[model samples]
Target chain A: MIAKEKFRVCPDTGFKVFDTTEKLIKINAVVAVVFLAVGGLFGLLVALTRWPAVHLLPADLFYLVLTAHGADVLLFWIVFFEVAVLYFAGSVLLNVRLAAPRWAWAAFILMLVGAVMANVAVLQGESSVMFTSYVPMRVAPHFYLGLILFAVGALVAMFVFFGTLVIAKEEKTYEGSVPLVTFGAIVAAIIAVYTIASGAIILIPTLLWSLDLVADIDSVMYKLVWWGMGHSSQQINMATQVSIWYCIAAMVLGAKPLSEKVSRGAFLLYIVFLQLASAHHLLVEPGISSEWKVFNTSYALYLAVLGSMIHGMSIPGAVECAQRRRGFNEGMFGWLRKAPWGNPAFSGMALSVVLFGILGGITGVVLGAEQLNIIMHNTLYVPGHFHGTVVAGTTLAFMAITYLVVPLIFRREIIWPKVAQWQPYLFGLGVTGISLFMMGAGTLGVSRRHWDMAFTDAPLNFDVPPAAFLMMGLNGISAVIASIGGIMFILVIVGTILFGKKRGEDACRTNPVILPGGGATVMAAGSEGTLKLPGTIALVSVFFAAFVLYYFVNWKYLSEVWPLS
Target chain B: MTEHLNSGDGKSGDSNGGPENGEQRIHAMQSLLDNPFLLLFIGVAVPTVLYTVWGVMEVVQVPIGQ
Candidate 1:
């Protein structure tokens, strides 16, 4: 018989928490926050350096900071937290033991070591090739090796997740189809396997080339393989974040998906067409052919966009449906208005859905279009778009879910409940400014990754528009504000986990976070068992308007660049 | 209405799913995701063929140092 001590039940929700599983979630999340703090600091420095007036770091250091910022936040921070999410979704949600707890520990150690090794390589001042590290621009051999190790570790973690799912099925953990959250995680893990495999296929050879064991690694091949890894990493984020969006909605507001069929179909769409977005990074490449480009571009990009757009609607529709059932029906947006805006769990997910869809989703579609790609391909517009997606959309979504994670998994009261309420808005506002201003600077033709915006010593002495300078100044200020938001999130969570009272400890205060307050009591007529989401429809229609206007705007901008005369 | 959301949580006792035993006896959407192996195969195979294989082939056709 298994050790009874290994399995205990959460009193609040009755989730079967394995002792090892809980530790893995806590440890991985803790480490992810550490990297977020480190990476966010570098990001702030990079932003200051970009601002013409501030010019925080010199050219050499600017590149170093940029490279570190990408690797740490993009790779280390997000992936570590994702690993935690994977375990929670699989073992915890399925109510099964994590398959091979020994292997899980080994995976954690390998990941931790690999992350440190890569950081060491970057900080050593020799490997400042940035995250892409495109071929013939060799980075330290250790950099490639570190990443390879990390990939191997992640692959191992994926195995444990899959194995646990098998255990759930065989043991009959709960019943019927595994939770939708677990299903979304399954999609993420599958994407991760494909992504990490792509990384290995390219990185191993690159590592050999770095060590002078190979003559050449083709640049075109590198681009193909690397983006299969790189862009797909974000795809993993999208799938995982959407899953958590559903989870937070269910846990916080007791919301059901408006249509489970539509929501699952949307996730299924990701499995089908999402990775094709690798083409977005390669649209401008010369080694690639026209037929190849067009086929990949049109065939893949928009279908994937359709998948994201589906999610954009479903999340809000579910939220509004839940609110209406609670008797909040008044106007088109009454359900939205009465939503628990003060609850970080609800607000964070809502903001992520809106910002990601409007800013990230729409801008991304335009960028992937061959004609529009030409104009914004090398501009700060690219970074602007990603900030909207990655930081504003994915990171904010992750931050939102962390509110739930702390209470649910960590079993602590939020140290400062009032501050927790406003964290998402502050962070959301800052990143919104970052994405918008950067895109504005990009529109005025600012270079994406260049250290010096002024070009003080260039031979041509070309002058960038004064407006672009102002945009970068605004972007710098936004970065500082976003960093403060990041700090606040870290402080709130860290303080809570380290020092806050244990949940349900005080008899008088029943831990509002555990059961989640702000519930609506009665089901309004015509609302019960109906998917009438006028509020969500109005919200999505607004998104549609934004997308159409932006699409035409970019096309018009393209016309200005290339005269028909 | 809210407890209908438990089909997602898969907790016991619900009209949408789960019997009194806490084992969800049946779920309509479960068909696709229930089989981890099949989904894994589909997810991995579809992309490998569609994106990776095709892209690598195109890259291989490029002339070097021409």
Candidate 2:
């Protein structure tokens, strides 16, 4: 062999500086926060309108706000933040620079322009198609155009992520296989591309219809394709949320998954399976073939859920291992006691996992079932279930990640650490209260999107008792409480960004903090500080198994028969 | 020009080094291009593009039913 000279390696891994990924994350976080505020305002309006006593706004205004809330919060805020997270994971975690910074900027601008145009059009009363923007409920051409532009921008961002992944592999920046978090994000990006493509398929025609280029469009087909966008986008949110859960756990607790291979394998399965799982949304819709519906709602949905479940179990497994390493002698649940409860990232993530499992997961699985869906479809329970998943699960995870990123990227201390500590609890409690109330009313046959339950002038078919209406009013109050928590969160975030103390000497330190784990034998001290492999793998694997189990059940039950027929 | 070149190398990697090390770096970059994940991304992306085009074509062909 030719004599090879050894190159001196940089100690810090040079991952932080060259990556402009952190800046991208900060920008996305700010935008997402604004969108969350806007979305919350709309949600408040809708809640008040639904409250029998309040009836705060007129029917028309109610619909507008309801539509805006869904579009802005569910679609816009989540997707934009997801793109930013994708950029962060693909570059920072993988130790690669962005493929094209200029292109990334272009994508952001396009998305912003689209969001602005869509909002303006909605406010002007030009498009009242609701968040689905279904055909036959025509909106202005600009509305569709804005949506197209945003989707295109997101598509470009995905391309850039893939490009960066290519560069990272070429650079040999990562020693082993890609990290679990980055792998999960890559899967999310892949699904996002498909979801956006589906959006373009439906929206372009709707735009044409608005321009009078086409006479009309099929409502049923439009719904089908739109769900391809709608439902699939939500799956992207799930994947991204799961990825963040892993990252937050790792960062805050210094926890690692027990089995890297299993966790990574679960992520790969998500990419292959989640996109096709959009059929669950159409199970209750008429005109869709029974075979397609069954295959979609049961089989595909189960697969997606299985992916989530695996991650759910895996995260806690890592936490347990980390706790044991920190010299906690508690038995099966002893690690939990020793774990850092004060850390915002750890608490937020732990709470999110619990809420998602008990509330979100249960409601999601039940709703995906054909027979159960018929009862819950278009009820207050529908929004209740989704809020548990998307808002409580995904949005809360994002907030937890933000707590970490704010310090790392913005170089600021957290303002109002005390108030920030209570945010997740108050907000989560309020959401749980509201969702439970809605679920109760829904069980008694309460409907959604109705202006007035008291107005008997129209023929009312369902016999909903007066108590249900009263309970809905109570739900509205819970929403108000949640909104207060949300406002406090925003203030804390803004304060941190503007005036938090910047870390000075501590910025140069790179010692890996050791977390509590299950045993000392499994924890080895090395140059990297402490290695807790089994715990990390266990944490990641539990969620992987849970997600797989959900999908398996869904496939077995829902995919075999078309519930609609 | 010299300053700009120096900065790029300093940020990225050491450009002026032993010929053998430089050659190894070049080989690494080439190997990265042949990564399976990169090829997988491209492979999936092409079909996705094609499907998008096909879906768009269907939209263009069918007239809106009044």
Highest TM-score among the candidates is held by which one? 1
- For model 2, residues A31-68, the per-residue Cα lDDT tens digits are 87888989888888888888888889987887788788
Over A435-534, each residue of candidate 1 has an lDDT whose tens digit, in order, gives: 9999999888888888987778988775889999999999999998898888899999999999987876342146565333311110100112345777
User: Could you tell me how far off, in angstroms, the CA of residue B6 lies in candidate 2 after the best superposition?
Assistant: 38
Which 10-residue span in candidate 1 chain A carries the lowest summed lDDT? A518-527
iRMSD of prediction 1: 7.6
Top-DockQ structure, candidate number: 1
Candidate 2 CAPRI level = incorrect
